[model samples]
Target: MRLEQALRSGRHLSTADPTEAELLIVNTCGFIDASKDESISVIRDLDSSRRKGQQLYVVGCLTEIAEAEVRATIPNVDATFGAEQWDAVAASVGPASANFDIPQPEFTNIKQPSAYLKISDGCDRPCTFCIIPTIKGAMHSDTVSRLIAEAKAHARDGTRELVLVAQDSTAYGEDQGDREGLATLLEQLSEAVPDLPWIRLMYAYPGRVTRLLAETMARLPNVVPYLDMPLQHASPSVLRRMKRPTVNKSRESINHIRKAIPDVVLRSTFIVGFPGETDSEFEELLTFIEEQRFDHIGAFTYSAQKGTPAATLLEQVPEAVKIERYGRLMELAQSISHDQNREMIGQEMKVLVESAEPTTSADGSPVVIGRTYRDAPEVDGLAFVKGEFKPGSMVDVRVEGALPYDLLCSPLDFHKP
Candidate 1:
């Protein structure tokens, strides 16, 4: 997004088609083997279809982590820049105009109902199974004043919902010597953008869900009661190996969050089939998932990344075992999710309508697909309401039916403007 804003400031026109653009930028991901493969595949496809005098540049996590391999494998790339090197990229691409030097916060969600406001960057946690810290470095939070300005910008640009994202949202201000930084920031953002209807938080680290944070969330009317805490695994032994907090600490944190926000929709991610993950440990994770009964569960099979500690760990679980465990974890999560959705039947929820289209259900009616407070924009489920509602309108919906990950809703009132 920063790069796009920079290019635009430099008077470079944007195009959706690669063949039309003079310079093609591929923002690549290198979080895991799968993402790396996907990135390489995309670059290869673009290179094969490149026209004369067109330049291809690779940037972002993949370029930052594995520049040599990228250069070696695909020598056609004109240049490479690491993450946050937007200025260097702009300089290399073309001469900057007078207005290019001016600092402007890039609003990716301009004209959209929802926008993601990145509060911070990087991670400080030393989870052995993770590669984010290695790629992005230690946590650095944006100033509260600056974030409030950005929040106001987003609010000014028709953003009804603002989603706060970071590599480690809970660790927002440790570098600035503020322990309650995120809580304080949220309070100020609520004040700064009072008209903005919804504020959602994502990527909260475990054991960092402070009392102040929970209380602030419960107190704020606009802040949604939804949390996305990625607890990779539950077994004490596995957590110890991954260098994460113990299961007991996680349990305590969960208890505290639920106690503070009783109606909060809890969403979590887990990693299955870690190296040397015994059957008992895997079973322990299943038991924890069943006991927690999370509203949303995102589970991934452990992918051993090169240069990570877990990659070289002994007793690496076979590919077949990882796939098997992933299926089982998702199966259990589905059943629990279905039960949770069933409990929400007949409840009213405010939905931020995303799209309205004709439905193919037995009843030949048009439907509006939107997300409730419980569901995030892309990584979560949707509420399908049978109606001819306008997109981006906030509508009151009553849950008439339930699916495993979505809600079958009916429009009650279009009260919100």
Candidate 2:
């Protein structure tokens, strides 16, 4: 949203140095207490800095969460707008505001080869531990036409890979009936940009991955065979308390996805501790994770979200217990991930070269660093190679070594299809 605002307003801003800018605006994500404090501190710094030729505006979820409080507490801010008040922010910028080319933030595989396009905003999940529905309100998916147009723009920008992001990608097109579902959207996107080699989806709900949706992924050549399904918790009792679908249904959904797409890379996240969760319930979760060794697993310890129903529940898991459980889950995931990667050794894999690792005096030689379809930019691991492969070029890689999170390999120069 920040980048879009700057692009629309035709303004250039710098995170490196702000003392020289005329108008300064800070976009804040005050979803939690810590984030709120950080926003306040930034606002206070801007207020106290009192730099010449500088103005400040505040916007984002923080403003929506505490609009009045922010205004009164941070009077130094010239203006404040909520999540819905983008028009006001756009109007605030005058002719003097500048603009710069903003590339999407990609931590790895960032060889100017990948781009991220947000297809939708907000979520409809009623999870008791989430604030997305409260802050961003109900489902509001972007139209398929607009998404295709934006994606085409990226393709023209020389983006070979595009990652689709949303609060809930699987809930796409739910707001409108005439819109064919996510499956249709994927099929349309594949047709829209046949030249763009790779298209990936992120943050899709496991429950929404219907059989047809799984099949669409299999049918679309450009779409990578990977799924990022964040099932916060797996125990049926805990899932019900969190307002999630039945655990058995989620399991069946996974089964269908794997059965239909044999090579699918499954990435999922879980919350180790939630309010009212007993050790026995957590043991159920541990057993569940053991059974489902997801290709990529991320775990987080539960924290209190102020406006969430989970926050008010009694028997809140202690911080110590949460950390302990979180540690155990991570430890188990490391072992499982290592074992999973070990299975890939010596297998020929297709990797999109993303960076060129320079050789130093002590280092052996230069190599093309990149990622496979299984890895998402920044969030997942990477593959390192040392050979003639060029950055931003696709190459065949033979996995020579594998670790819990990183893959090491050498390029196959002579191998031909």
Candidate 3:
């Protein structure tokens, strides 16, 4: 998504190159079987080119999760590391052989407007269906001062938005100090880097989400009205079996946000057909989705992740049942999304123009595409506007139409200076 959008506008993106490029990296997500499979597939494509003079490295969750396995399989890897290995990767690639350091993250920030700033490492939550804790380890948050400094650097570097990410963002400071916790850190971050246009939070757990967090978000102008409030499942029984200690408080949380800021966007993810999940539990999930009518909804089927508690649980769901449940959840989300998008059709909204794609229109006119603040880079949607829009230029546009993901809009070019 970043390449397709950024490269179209003459922007230099930093991933993947022809066999001749000086450096190459295989960024992997080793959280689940599917992601692991995808990462290995990429590794295989490069593993055979040993004779070819190329500098290759592997990083991310897989580096730590299955480090031994990866080393055995892909011995050609010059370097292998995870979240804590950024410094090591730097040294391996640069003159600084050790304690290597730099101002910017070497890996490409694939999204527009909002660049992901991984503030903390690992997961503290004991969600049974998750493998992040096993793969990424326990939570180890970066110092608040460093985070503040980084946010300022990003702002000065032209990043309009800062996306705070961690396995459990809410647990950022628990492992460190007294003045920790994601909510408090967020408040300080906004204070430290007030110029940043938006700060969006992601990977937040349901139970750890305190009342103060909502208030903090509401008070902070830069904090985007969007929240990735991942409520894995709503059924109390399933939640218990899954070791998701969080009591289902979707109603209270949703109501508080709505009461405070009526326009807030709540994004959530769910997993259907979990181990021992029954018809009643499935119905509860359906009811939760119906009641939530979330602005954004992401759902997945039960996939066994090694070392997760749920993986060993009895009554494993059949593939067919998992697929069926996923389909139904998706269908419900789509219907709700269509209606929500329809409501946005007539509204004038601010969109951060991404990049232009070279394509002919139906009538043979040139066209460019982009996204609004509400739409994330790849996972969410796009704004297809037939006009001259410079990537990174924030502009206002009237929402002309809508689909499940992409939105159609006409640019209000006059709004820009």
Which lDDT values do the candidates have, in the order given? 0.86, 0.79, 0.74
Backbone clashes in model 3: 0
Residues 114-138, candidate 2, lDDT per residue (tens digit)?
8887777888788888877898988
Q: lDDT per residue, candidate 1, 194-280, as tens digits?
A: 999999999988899988899999899899999989899999999999999888878877887898998789999998889999999
**TM-scores, one per candidate:** 0.91, 0.84, 0.85
Model 3 C-alpha lDDT per residue in residues 1-417, reported as the tens digit of each score: 222222223322354444655556777887766678888888877777634677678888887778888888877787787745655555556542234333334233344456777778777677888877777777888888877866776676677778888777877777876433777888898888887777888877765667777788889988888878778889988888877754446566666666667888778888888998898899998998888788778887888877787889889999898899999998998888788888899899877766644344587865567777676555666777766666666677898889987788777764467
Reference-based TM-score, model 3: 0.85
Positional deviation of residue 227's Cα in model 3 after best superposition, in angstroms: 0.7
Ranking by lDDT: 1, 2, 3
Query: Which 10 successive residues of model 2 have the least lDDT summed?
Result: 102-111
lDDT of 3 at 30: 79
Residue pairs clashing in model 2 are: 11-98, 11-99, 12-98, 12-99
Better of 1 and 2 by TM-score: 1
> Over the full model, what C-alpha lDDT does candidate 1 score relative to the true structure?
0.86
Q: What is the lDDT of residue 75 in candidate 1?
A: 96
Misplaced by over 4 Å in model 3 are 1-20, 46-51, 67-79, 91-112, 176-180, 356-360, 413-417
Index of the highest-TM-score prediction = 1
What shift in Å separates residue 346 of candidate 3 from its native position after superposition?
Answer: 0.6
**Root mean square deviation (Cα) for candidate 3:** 5.4
